[model samples]
Target: MGEPSAPGTPRGDRLHHPQLTTLVDTARFHAAHSPQVTAVVCEDRALTYARLHRESNRVAHAIRATGAAPGARVAYLGKESEHYYEILFGCAKSETVLVPINWRLTAPEVSHILQDSGSDLLFLEDEFGPVLDRLPTAPPKTVVRLAEGTGPAAWTAGHPDTDPALSPTPDTPVAQLYTSGTTGLPKGVVLAHRSFFAVRDALAGAGLDWIDWRAGDIALVGIPGFHVGGLWWATQNFNAGVTVASMRAFAPREAIDLIRDKGVTTACVVPAMLRMMLGEPGVEPDDFTTLRKIVYGGSPISEALLEESLALFGSEFAQIYGLTETGNTAVCLPPADHIPGHPRMKAAGHPYPGIGSKVIDGEGKELPTGAVGEICLATPAHMVEYWALPGKTAETLVDGWIHTGDAGYVDDDGYVFIQDRIKDAILVAGENVYPAEIENALERHPGVAEAVIVGAPDERWGEKVHAFVVPVAGREPSPRDLHRFLVDRLAAFKLPAAYEFIAHVPRNPSGKILRRALRDRFWNDADRKVN
Candidate 1:
């Protein structure tokens, strides 16, 4: 129960984000300034800013009727919908933390997060009922299904549409998103209202067109709302009082059609989606005429993919590098350096305005330029802490910096080159083998559509380089030929000792390669997931 950020006072850096300070501010500000603007598009329904704000007020009162007050957690498990914003902004207005669930997760995974967050009320779509039934135990809270003219909407209609004016400061807990839990159990990353607005101020201060959010600009929300990427993307547009075209689920074809049909000016997508969109039928040079920018991240983009993407979309590309812990993009590779052959194109761009980053050695000391070390970032948008995990938070957020588990180096020109995940990096007879290097090289081959490299258990070499490749349609090259192609490009040891051709490489919802899943097939009997 903290007081609202002393009326108009700016927090974090000296830069002031005049748009909104808290999560609920989007509805409040936009409803007053641009009431008739179409704020969200999900399917056939579009919610105007005024109606969105008014509906959120009623929803806030409805949630309050459930006996949940400020600081209580309310979870939502469902797909992207126009009503999703009502639930989000309403909870914000009610001064409750919104815990958005990943619909792709299993029952156990979802259950763990609900239990961890201590949610007092669960709002889910009718389709998700089966998932709840699969769970061993129900969410220990009141459950309400969300749908039109029924459930949450029906119940909320009885309440009046008036702002509660609950006072929540910028430091107040707003949303708590659980991590993907690749290496371990998922932990809720607690976000304050500042986690988002801080980024807003930084982007405005930098004065970059790539993120120069403006009215009439349509943004395609392809990523799920559960990830910080999607939430931040939507927030940016909301902050600018612009329109967001939502794709309930990300299908490359549907996404392309939405961009063209909606005149989407910019979008945030991963490299995999870009590849799929380029390969989709009916793709033409003019198909993406309205798209001016494409911000991609989650995983590094291969040089081959980057070149193809530039030729296909014809949009200025910006690369973002950050994690859920840092809210979103702390460092941005601006569109200017997206040149196909530029050396800096391969590097993660410099830190955003008001954000500081440095390479730190194992001892937590700053590493000199060109020396590989952990990339530590101190951004205004850093998450408050790992929910209820102080020990883990202490290990990650040391001092004012978050030690990014990524192994990379800051070059003399202040460009950061991410090598690979330190935990995923393999040691072959004391020689480090970064899977990305091999995967990038494999992807460059004209016959290979995509590639993923991982370390396999080996007695003699400690761990051996293993590659899974998806060949181009109607093309098949022997492993020996692929080896010869790599022999000249990579060290002899870096070349894959084993190769398996597959239809596709499995990836997580965020577009990150599930290297653990790939490695698991070979080491089913092993005790640990990592080699």
Candidate 2:
């Protein structure tokens, strides 16, 4: 944490507020300081700071009325909305953990999360009632229906709108966000109240604006709240006492219009969402005039797409890199390093002021600079553990550092350059080929909009690289053309052996490419079993 300013000073008074350590304190502080400020707006509903605080208080009372004790799990299955934020703070005020499940999951997936979390109560939107009916077993101990205008239920409305007056420390568990499960079963990453405010505290009076919050800035929460990125972004803005406009679900055309109509000054999204917004018809630079900065992450982006987006959006772009375990971002490629063709454009930026990062070999020894190894990060915002998986938690969280399974190297200047997931490397004739390297090269082509690389089981060699390409609108490049373009860049062994052109690549809600889905088609046909 950064050093505190002198007492009695404005900065000191603002940064050292006694009521800013937990989510409960945050809601109270903002409501007391700016009661009439619009805290959150979703669709046609808006909540002022005063209303959010009072409504969440009623929700806390309602939660206790259901016999849910402190520290119990409260699950919410719904899209992004003002109601979601209300439930989140309600869970906070009641000293319960909030589990926001991915609404896009199927019935089995939803059931698995509900069962695994041992939730005491559930709050679900009416839109997913069918999923609830298909559950193999009974629902949680208590289930409440959430509608657009009903707001939790009429019973909750009858509860008192006064603070529960419960006190939770900064280390109290407040949120449990699940992993995307691209590699295997999703593990719940439990984050405490401190996770949401670590970066903000680190930036206090540091004279850095790498990611800053200002008054009158309306942030757009395009990503869903189930993802840590979206949840963290919204909370950070709220902690700064700024208004946020959240979408029920992301629609590119609707998002563009919201930016224009709401005068949104800051936004967060993944690279895939940016592509979709740019692809929308009749979108012009003027449509995004209100945006001052745009934060992007969740997957590696090609230089071609970044340059195009920078030109169209005309906003400062900052790239973030991290996993759900690290509370969203441990490294940020700031707007200053966003030059189109600069070498540092490919580098993941330096760690935040208080965060620590390093690369270590399989033997747990620190590696020299520029040597690829598993990237590990030590941050105050690191998760407490994987829910009910002590062994997995120990394997991942080592000595206060989280072993991020990603392979990367640090330069002399401390810029981290990610290669790919260590397990995703493809082996051909004893040579290693990283899918991201090939995908970056393919996306550099003018005709390619996006590309994904996956490894397929082979009889001759252990594995071969296969490419899935999404062409730009009105342009189609054949395999021969791609091969000719890449012949001089990548070695013959690293080149893809086959190509499959598709309309769009499959991605999770967080915008990570589903490499396993593409690779499974080949392995299933070849009778080669893989995890």
Candidate 3:
């Protein structure tokens, strides 16, 4: 008989195999090909590919010395930094899973993750001392603070000229990225080495071919490192032998200046960050000339902002759509979509090669084109499983397909248009009103700066469509005017029953509207969690 495939070996197709075990190989590959090339750039430090490889190895050895078993979870709680990537790569080298905690999370939320993951060690940035203090119990293992004087100096030292032994298997768990959990407590999504690398290949296939990601390209990573955008993008650049400019904090002006001063070629941001950058005082055209590609997602962008951005930055914008469970983006709206008259420009473009996507009904049967339903995908980048949440994992993943819970419709031309969360659908007087459609219409109004629509309870109708709006600077359009603006564009039933003006809308770090927070104000005393 033929030899049985080893545990974690690729089955049938090597291209679709998992990557939990090959972290060391990836790190070593960059080290050999781009040793002297800058791999990471932080506020006060720079690391070449050789340096990142060596330092990651030292950190891996340190983790192993702590008696952490292979596959043990190691948590990193901090803002974005070179140390974050170092620890991530380090944990992967030692066959340990790295879990990055969202810096925006509250103490209670952070406590939940640390306890749930049963992390063997917690590496924290100094700024999070207060959050760490709120933990009910110390993490199960060591707590190493990333500061000037804490722990061994070698742990934080940058390696400029040393090579450490590489040890990683393809199936080893590299990371466990937690979902944002807008509806409930977050779940950790376990990603193998292969799944992580697949994202890089997917990016390349999605029109990032112009990236020139050899040892010369400088990648600026400004998003939160805990989030998939920061973590995955940084790793992709590193693997491609590109330098990474890591920002510890996100300030729009500083970020813009960094792009100009550092010769940064690539960047990733959400729509809100782009809005902020455009609104920043003294912001001039070509301020981002050094940027080659501006990858954006986590929320939709209006056509108005899209046109303004195209005028401001030229043709360098690409939209990506995915979640933590999918490692990163499974589908990309390529730069070509920015071209005028492109049919899919208004939609989320096609799925990446090697990724299968479909819109499905409640029965899991595929829905035909132009039908709105849950968007499901089968991809090599899907997470292995959710940590400590078997039932939840089972519910989300089935037969290699990950149910996205996001409501979207595929057009006859194969373009996908996301509507709203299935859970957030507004049922008003027996009519279905998606908040995104309303919000998009409201945003099209010249006086409306930003808008969020939610379903508020009503006696006559099951629920009422309520809109919270932020007006543009020096532009005050009353509720009636705004209503008149949308009257012709939307169905009469979809109009907002009430309007409230707010200075700003609540959002997560990723720029996603916190609808649950908005809904909580009205439904705090309700029986169920959501309406």
Candidate 4:
């Protein structure tokens, strides 16, 4: 990692606080100001700020009854719901770290996280009970359902509405988000309340209005809450005391309906979701009249699709750039830069206020302007560390700077441009999917001897997973055969889009796979570029 670059335009602004403010205090603050305002809304439930604050206290008291110590892990396995936020705030009040698992992961993958976190208690959706049964080792923690009248709900009802008033410091961790490990195992990226809250305070304190949180925004949350991007977006809205219209998952038609019916004014979506919405039935430019801004990230957007969306939604488009380790987004392409034919359209915009970044060469020296190098950024939003992986943490977070494993360059104007991913992790439809994980799953098949996974350029999703397979001695594996084998073993998004049969998988002399060589075959066009 490189040393911090001089604070540029946005960085000149100073942080306002001497210490991090607890998220529990944030809830209390909102309740005091907007007691009757809608805070969280799901299918048929809308929780007011006062109710949300009181209920979270009850949840915290109930969780305390479970014998969970401070900083103990409390895991949730399910889709987005009011219950999710309840559990989130409840954990915050109890000083417990919340671990939101990716429900799309296979049973083994889920079990690995559960085992690693050693979570004291798990409050999961009833639908996920079968998945838990598929775990190789029975999880030893207490499991409760996240439903009304369940054991957990009954316990919460028995607790007082008064606050526990547990004192938690700014350094206290809030969540542990697991990133798909490039080496075939997932590693937890631990974030504190300061990781998200402090950054927002600093930006607003500096008069950064690109993400100005305003009341009556009516935000639509279509991103999966398991990822840091989704979680931070939702929290940003709540921090501003805005009404949040939550979605269980992103469905094109459902999003359109929410914008039209719920009068949603803003949303945090991915490029693929924008593409999917264009094809949804009955969608027209006027359908999104209520929407003012659409902030998208996780994958790059094609110029053609951006043009279509610009005309259709008639809403300002902003691009965000960051990773799990940086608390979702450290840089943003403001609405002013979204102009047609603008040069900064491809730029990731300047570093957020108070964010420090540098483009550095392999020697750890800052590169000259326009020189492609690894992007290193430091900010209040940066995660504290990789959970329990001190060695990996030391390698990634060097001297308080997070070495983003992305190759990029900074222009003289201070705009950053992302060129490629240095790490072999593939982003599929905004979700990080590593090739090694897919290859490991493929090798388990009897008909497959060896496999190499690569990302191919895709119009909808920024990249699609492509597999090159070499069959075992006498078995020739067809695409259908391999697809059938992986259907239940992996998430649908991680399934290979195309398969090529070869005699052997390519590797270097040292027995390491030359993934770039294999990946280059599908990305030969000069026109192919990602933000």
Candidate 5:
């Protein structure tokens, strides 16, 4: 056993400590150092570090009393709230892995996750009561309904609160995050204690100071806790002794109001969410005065949007790039890179200090600078393995590097410029076209609001580029007009062969455009996989 260190202290000059493998240590550290500080604030309720620790302890005890084994997986189906954090830490302390179900998933999808993970117990909010009742499983292992009061109300009344003395093994699994799986059904991404701690340490070493993490500083957590971004960001701030203000759903007006009224200094959002915030009619340049940092990611930002945000928020912006499999962030474009004149501003800054990343070809050969290829990553934060999918896991995690199917090139200065996902690349008339590049060009057009480029089947060409566009409010641009506009901006071959105007582009809960969904609609009758 190792002595408990300060919350933000780097362990042994390494990004992750080899011994501090349990997430419970984060709660313990805060309980010892800042017991009285408010650790979570949701709706009208609040939990100090001490209160949170005690609550998590009670939950852990209850979980164990339910016959959950040390390595058994427990699923949490709820929105962002203090209870969510409590259950997360409780699972950690009890040596159980938590599988947080995305609230946006349908009943069938949720059932699939539950059956796939073989979850022994489920902690669900009252909102999901009907969904739980509809599960086709028999006797349903155990279900706990979360409410404002203490003892189980409405569900599992006889459950007892077990003691908080359960000790976790260092290598125990802590969390199992389900990947969005654009190509197939979602697979559970297993994350061990070591993997999570590695990410926490790496984030701390990123050199970006979080204002809301200071004593009495307010942090607004609007992102869904089901995603890695929300879960880890809230956990990190809690460990640092900050007051977390959470919301069940993200409404731009409500989020802005929370920041303004509650003195929120830090927040995380994806590009689409930020765009919505910027679109709010009442928003002003000074509306975010208390905001010290706005961590944005999930997709690249347009240069125009970046400039506009910089003009409004000053220099308090940071861009992070990574997936759930890599534990939230493996690359960070820090605040300094927000400088418009900085050469790396357009690039995804350098790889995080301790994270190993490279641009490689299909044969695993390292590509030189300025060469576009697969972006592979190696880090302690890499996921343990995909649950029940050894073959898929072996393919993705080869020789320790998690091959991120994203295509990108590294510049001479070591800045990474991601072109697009390899699987998302469209072949139009035998010409390779990256949707991101075409979308970027289309977004530059004044009349376009949102655009998604997908490959549609064609007899002449293997696949043709089909663009689904959402035009600006009250301004509809003709397909021919847009085609003419793109002719000069992009290669003629990259222009969309057909165009369809839609009210809105379909996106996943995390705001990633559901390109696969769009492609599926067009290829429903096709025999091929890549349409």
Candidate 6:
């Protein structure tokens, strides 16, 4: 495996304190430095650094009152709000692990996570009260309702607003985020305090500004906190002592309005959110004038969409690619490489300082440079393990390197290009066909808005390529037109054998394309899922 350029030595910065290694330390440090500054603002409620520190302290006491031991799991089921941050920090302060559940999950899904994690307490938003009634079994031992004048504010009222002074090492587990469960049941991924701050520490003086923070910069957390992207981004900003304006929920119009009203300087968003914001009615360049930089990822973005977003927002855009297992971002496509037609725009970018990435063949041997194989990552931010699943953990985290199931390769310059998930690769007559390549090509057509590629069982060839296309408004290109457009760009085996035009593609909350949902339809009755 080819090694990327070595990361620079660590250095200290005015904003970063060497003594502050944990989130609890960051909370205390920022409180002392920027006490009056607004730390987090959600909806109509806001919390200053001082107030946040105090309230979170009370929450720590209240959680301890419930008898939750250190390392105990505490789950939160709710939309983003100021209370969410309090609970997050409180869990950190009290030495408990915070597990943020996806509010969009069904009751059964929610039940499985809560039960599987063995959460001792649950903080539920009043909006989801009915979810408890629909659950398959009993809920946690302690359920705190978040409502007007009741939630954390009331529960923590009697407790002293002072730091618990609990000591947790840098490696202490603090957050437990679950996987998407695309293959099977979701497994809880445990992360320690070091996971959140390792990259920053490593890149302190690396002089690479792929993603940087500044004083007085107001950041928008458009992605929900339940996802590692949202939580990690928010924590990074808080560590920098800046104001963060989080949305109660991501709505295209509201996100635009928030940018205009709050003068949001930077934001972390997925490509879907960018597409939706650009498509919002009456959205103009002025609506995003305050935006100086946008960090986007979660899925590959089309060239057309990237150009449109750049022209409309007139902001520097950076693409980050990583999984929750890698503590959100292991690589970043810097702003300089974001040129509309640049080949590097398709690359997943070089790894951050101190991150190790390599491509390996099926036999567990490392592949040479420019060879396509499974991409693996070794970083300080790697997860501790999948909660309660030693076998699954062993299979994924081997010898300190995460076996990222993504199929990709590294160029001579160290840029990683992700093809598609290994399991998502279609076999056509013993040849490999990656859907991302075809999807990228299809999306380049003016008449096509989005395309999803899947493998369908075939009588002759073991598997055939099937595509679901979403046409641009007022334009529907025929299958022949699509084929003609892709003929010169893709190989014969990579081209879609059939096409079905649709209105929109189904995506999860974090904006990942649900390939399994569409692929399963073609193989429901097959003797085996694979061709």
What are the per-residue Cα lDDT tens digits for candidate 1 across 363-424? 88888778888888888789999999998899889887887787888776566777645556
Clash tally, candidates in order: 0, 0, 11, 0, 1, 0
Best by lDDT: 6
TM-scores vs. true structure, each candidate: 0.78, 0.79, 0.74, 0.94, 0.75, 0.80
Q: CA shift at 249, candidate 5, in angstroms?
A: 1.4
Ranking by lDDT: 6, 4, 2, 1, 5, 3
Q: What lDDT does the true structure give each of the candidates?
A: 0.77, 0.81, 0.71, 0.82, 0.72, 0.83
4 or 5, which is superior by lDDT? 4
Top-TM-score structure, candidate number: 4
lDDT of 1 at 440: 72
**Candidate 5 — which pairs collide?**
61-162
Across residues 1-531, which tens digit of lDDT does each residue of candidate 3 receive?
011111111122112212323667767877876678777888767877787787777788788778888889999887776667778778877788998887666566678789888897898778878888876667556888888323234553553323345466555678887763433455788988777577555544443442225435677776677777777777777666668898877788888888888888778777666767778898877787777678876655556677777776653777777777777787777666766556566576556656777888998888887787888877788888988878888988988888887788776545567755665756553334568777877998999999998887664344689999999989979999998988755557678999999999999999988988997687777533222
Supply the global lDDT for candidate 5: 0.72
Worst 10 residues of 2 by lDDT: 1-10
In model 3, the Cα lDDT at residue 382 comes to 85
Candidate 5: lDDT of 225?
82
CA shift of 470, model 6, Å: 25
Taking the tens digit of each residue's C-alpha lDDT, what string does model 2 give over 43-73? 7778899999998999999998888888889
Candidate 5 residue-wise lDDT at 356: 75
lDDT: worst 10-residue window of model 1:
1-10
Tell me how far the alpha carbon of residue 68 in candidate 2 is from the true structure, in angstroms, after superposition.
Answer: 1.1
Cα lDDT tens digits, model 5, 403-511, are: 8787887776556677555667564422345677678778888899999888876643446788999999877899988988887555465679999999999988998
